[model samples]
Target: MLLLQANNVERRFGADILFHNVNMQIDEHSRTALVGRNGAGKTTLLKMIAGITEPDEGTISKAHDLSIGYLAQDQGLDSQNNIWDELDSVFAPLHEMEKSIHQLEEKLSSIDSTTDEYQYIIQQYDHLQTTFKEQGGFEYASKMRGVLTGFGFGEDMYDLPINSLSGGQKTKLALAKILLQEPQLLILDEPTNHLDMNVLNWLEDYLRGYNGSVLVVSHDRYFLDHVVSQVYDLDNQTLTHYTGNYSAFTKEKADWLRAEMKHYDQQQKKIAKLEDFVNKNLVRASTTKRAQARRKQLEKMDRMERPTTDDSSIHFSFHSDKDSGNEVLDVENLKVGYNENVLAGPLSFKERKGQRIGIIGPNGIGKSTLLKTILKKQPAISGSIKLGANLEIGYYDQEQQQLHPDKTVLDEVWDDHPEVPETEIRSLLGSFLFVGDDVFKTVKELSGGQKARLELTKLSFQPINFLILDEPTNHLDIDSREVLETAINEFTGTVLFVSHDRYFLNQVATDILNMSSTGITHYQGNYDDFVNETSTLSQNEDKTTIPSTTQTSSKKSAGQQSYQASKQNQRARRKIQREVDKFEQEMDSLQAKHDQIEQQMSAPEVATDIAKLSDLQKQLDECQQQLDQAEENWTDAAERLEEFDQE
Candidate 1:
C-alpha cells in the first residue's frame, strides 16, 4: 500500500525556485534517504509531504491511518515539565487507560458490593487492568529510562525542567519523543547531527528492524548506507529516485546518466540527418515528396532535455607542523561527570603524539564530557589533566551555542583575535566555505550545521596544535565536510575529537576511543577496526578482551536469526557484485578486441590486400558478435545491480 503521494509539487523561496514539478510516492515499509545540496529544496519537499506548508502547485496525499512523526533539526521544547515528564507524554494513551481503570474501581466502591451493577463494574475494571498490563503500562518507566539514556539525556537531566535545556538538548529530547512514539512513517531531519557513533550504531540496528517506514534527511553517509534502501535526490528542480544505498546509488546513477547520453546522441544524429535531407531537397522539384516525408519524421522526434551535472567539490589542506612532544595530554585518576556522580571511571587515559582518536559511545555516555574535561571547562571532580608544552587547543563545541547571537560572522572572527587583520580573518573564513553575503548573517540565524562550520572557521585561524572537536561536521555541507576533514588529516597535531560521522572518522581518525560508564577504551585502529573487534566479541563473548584504555560495554546481544539474516543479505549482494565485476572484465576484453579489429581495418596495407582483408572481415564479424554478447551481459548486470540497490 502507498503510504504517501505528492504530485507536481512546486516550491519557491522569494525569487529562487528550490524545486518544481516534483512527484513522488512513498510506499509501505519504504526507507527513503533524501539528499541534495544545501539549498536544493530537500527540507521544503519534506515539509510539503508532512502537510506543514502548502505547495505552490499540486497536492499531497497520505494513506488512510498512516501516522507520520517528523523530527525537525531545529525545534523547541516549550513545556515546563521535566525531561522525563516530556518524553513520557508520548505514552499518553497508556496513561489514559490506567486512569480509566482507577476511575472504574472507584465507581464500583461507591455502589453496593452485592449489587449486579457493582459486580459488572468489577469485571470491567479487571478487563481494563489486563489491557493496561498488555500495553506495557506496567513497565513504561523502565522503557522511558532506557530511551532517554539512549538519546543522551543524563539521569540528572531527566528531572531537569525542559525549559532550561540547551537547544541541542531539546533536539535530543524531541528525537527521543519521536522514537518512543514509533509512528507508522518516520521523517527525521538530520537526526544524527548531535548524536555520537554509539547512538548512531544503535539507531542503525533499531531502524533496520523497525516495523514501520522511515524517510531520513541526513548528511551522514555511513548512517544513510546502513539504514536506507532508497535515495531520493532533490536536485535541478525535479525528483530523481535512485534505488540503493548511497554507494550503490552513486555507481548506478552514473551508469544511468551515461546510457541516457548515448541515447541522446543517437537521437541527435537522426534529427541532423532528417534536417539535412529536408534542406537539400525541399526546394528541388524532383524530390519534393521525399523532403516532406523527411520533415514529418523530424517533427515527430522526441528531443531529450539536457541533464543537470553535479558541480566540482571543494577541498582544504592545512599547513603541516612538527609533531608535538610525546605526551599530548595525560589524565591521572580522571573521575568525570556532571553535578556530583562519576560517569564510568576513576579512569586514566593519555593521548600520545600522532594519535588520531575517535571517541564513541551512546549519547549520554560522556563522550563530549570527556573532551570538556580536557578543555578544563567541565571540571574533573577529583582528577587532573596534564597538557604538554606548546600544546595549543582548538575546541569545536556542538552547542556552537557559543558564537554570541549578536555577533556577525565577521565580528565573531575579528572579536576573538584582534591581533589578526581583517583580510587574514576573511581569508580564513573563506577557507571554511563562508563567502560573500554569508559572512554577514548573524551567528544567531545560522543553522546548527552553519554555526558548526563558523565555529570551526574561527578555530582554524588560530594557532592550535592540539584540537578538541565535538561533532565538527554537524552543520557542514558535503563540500565543507571534505575541507574540514582534509585539514584535520594534514594537521601534524594530535586530535581528540568526538564525532558520529563514520565517513569522516574513516578518513581522519587513526585510533578508536570508546568512552562509556567505565571511562575511555582505546582500540588500536579507526571506527572500522572498532566495529570489527566488537563484531568479533559478539561472535566470541568469552574470549573478548577490550582495551584497558576503554570502558566495558553494555551486556548487549544480537539475536542469532537477525545476525544471520544480515550476513546472508551481504553474501547475496556480494554474489551480485561479483557477477557485475565479471561482466565488466569481459566487456573490457571485448572493447580491446574491437579496437584491434578497427586498427587493422584502418591500415592502408589491409585496404590494399583484398585476400587478407576478407580474412580480417570474418574475424571482425566474430568480434562484433562477442561485443554484442558482452553488451547484453553488461546491461543485465547493471539492471540487476539497480534492482538490488533499490530494494
Candidate 2:
C-alpha cells in the first residue's frame, strides 16, 4: 500500500527556488534514502513531507490516518521526566485501555449473568482484551527496554533525569522513544550523527526488522547501504529515484550521466548540421526547398539539454616535502586522558611511514584524546610517544578549534604563511570552494562544512610528512568526504586518524586500531576486514569447551607409542567429525523452517490478518532462536575437529 506520495513538489525561498518538480513515493515497509550535498533542501523537503511545513507549490499526499514520526537533525527530547518515564509515555493509550479492561472485569464479576448490562460489559471487556493484545500491550515494557538497551542505555540509566543527560544522549533517547511509538512511517534526518559503531550496528539491525516504512537522510554511506533499499538523489535542483542502495545509485548515476551526455552530443551535432545546410543552401533556388524542409525538421525536433555535473567540491591534495624515517611514530604504554584520569591504555602501537591507520572504538574511549596526546596538545597520563626524525606533522581537529573564529577565511590561510602572496592565498581558498566574498566570511559565521574545508585548506598549505586527523570527516558531506579520502590515499605521508564513518575507513585505512578500555588490538586491514576477523575470533571464543586428553608415556618402543597415539587421534577426529555433521544437519533444517515461516508471514492473506501475522512472527522468531543455537553447536564441533586435525 502506498503510504505517502509527493507530486510535483516545489520548494522555494522568496525569489530563489531550492528545488522543483520533485516526485517520490513510499509504500508500506519501504526502505528509502534521501541523499544530496549539503544545502540541497533535503531537510526542507522532509519537513514538507512530514507535514511540519507546507510546500510553496505542489502537494504532498499521505494516506488517511497515516502517522509519521520525524526525527530532525540533532533534535532531542525535552522533558522533566526521567528516561524511563519519557519512553513510557508513548504507551499512554495502552495503559488507559488496560485500566478500562480492569474496570470492566470488576463490573462483569459483580453483575448478573442474564442481564443486558452484564452481557454488554463482558463484550466490552473481551474487545478491550483483544485490542490490547493486538497492540502489544503485554510486550510494551519489554519492547521499551530492548530499544533502550540497543541505544546503549542500561537499566542503571533508566532513572536518570532527561535534563542530566548530554545532548547526544538526549538525541539518542528521542530516537528510542520514536521507535517505541512505532508510527506507520519514520522520517529521520542525520540519525547516525551521534551514534557510535556499536549503536550504529544495533540500529541497522532494528531498522531492517522495522514493521513500517522508513525514509532517512544520512551521510553514513555504510549505514545507507545496509538499511535503505532505494535511493532518491536530490541534486542540481531535482530529485531522481534510483532503485537500489547507495553503492548501486552511484554506479547508476555515473552510467546515466554518460548516457545523457552521449544523447546531448548526438542531438547537438544534428542541429549543427541542419543549421549549416540552411546557411549554405537557403538562398540557392534549387536547394531552397530542401533547406526549408531541413529548417522545419530542426524546429520540430526535441532538443536535449546538456547534462550538468556538480563538481564544486573541495579540491586539494596532501603532499609531503620530505620523506620520513621507516618508523614514523612509536608509542609505548601510552595512557591518554586528562589530568590524572585514564580513559584508554596502557595502549601501545607503532606507525610505519606511509601507513594510514584508522582508530575506532566506542564513545568516550579517548580516540580524539589519543591524537591530541600524540601531538603534545595534552599531557599523557603516563608512557612515551616518539616521533621519527625530520617529521613535520599536520593535524585536523574534529572540533575545528585550530581555526580562529574572528578571522576571515582568506586571512586564516594567509596569516599562516605571510610570505605567500594575497593572490596565491585567494586562489588556494578558491580550490576549497571559498570564492570571492566567501573568503571574507568570518570563521564563526561559517557552517561546520565550510569550517572543515578551511581547515583542510590550511593543512594542504603545510609541508608535513605525518598527518594526524581526529574525526576529519565529522562535518564533511559525501562528496567532500570522498575528496578527503582520495587526498589521503594519494598522499605520500603517514596518516593516523579517528573516524566513525565506516565507508571512509574502508576506503583509506591500510590498518585498523580497535581501541577498548583494556587495550588496543591492531588488525592488518580496513574496517570490513577488522569486523570479519573479529567476528571469527568472537565465534571461536564462544565455542563450547572441549575436554583435554592426557597422553601417557608407555614402557614400549618409540615407534609403537607413535603408532598407538596416531590411531587414538584418528578415532577422536572421526568422532568430532560425526558431531559436526549432525550439527550441520540440524542447522540446515532449522534455517529451512525459519525461511518457510517468513514466507508464510509475507503472504497477502496472512499479512492483513493481524492474528495470523502475529502467530507466524512468533514461529519465525522461535525458529531463528533454534537456528542460532544449532549454528553455535556446529561451530563448536567444527572447532574440535580442526583442533584434532592440527594435533
Whose lDDT is greatest here?
A: 2
Predicted candidate 2 versus true structure: per-residue lDDT over 225-266, tens digit per residue = 778999998998889999987877886898799889999998
Taking all chains together, each candidate's TM-score versus the true structure is 0.66, 0.82
lDDT agreement with native, every candidate: 0.79, 0.90
Local accuracy of candidate 1 as per-residue lDDT tens digits, 362-418: 666777777888888888878888999767777888877668998899899899889
Clashes of each: 10, 0
Which 10-residue window of candidate 1 scores lowest in summed lDDT?
549-558
RMSD of 2: 22.2
State in Å the error of residue 626, model 2: 63
Worst 10 residues of 2 by lDDT: 548-557
Give Cα distance to truth, residue 621, candidate 1, Å.
Answer: 43
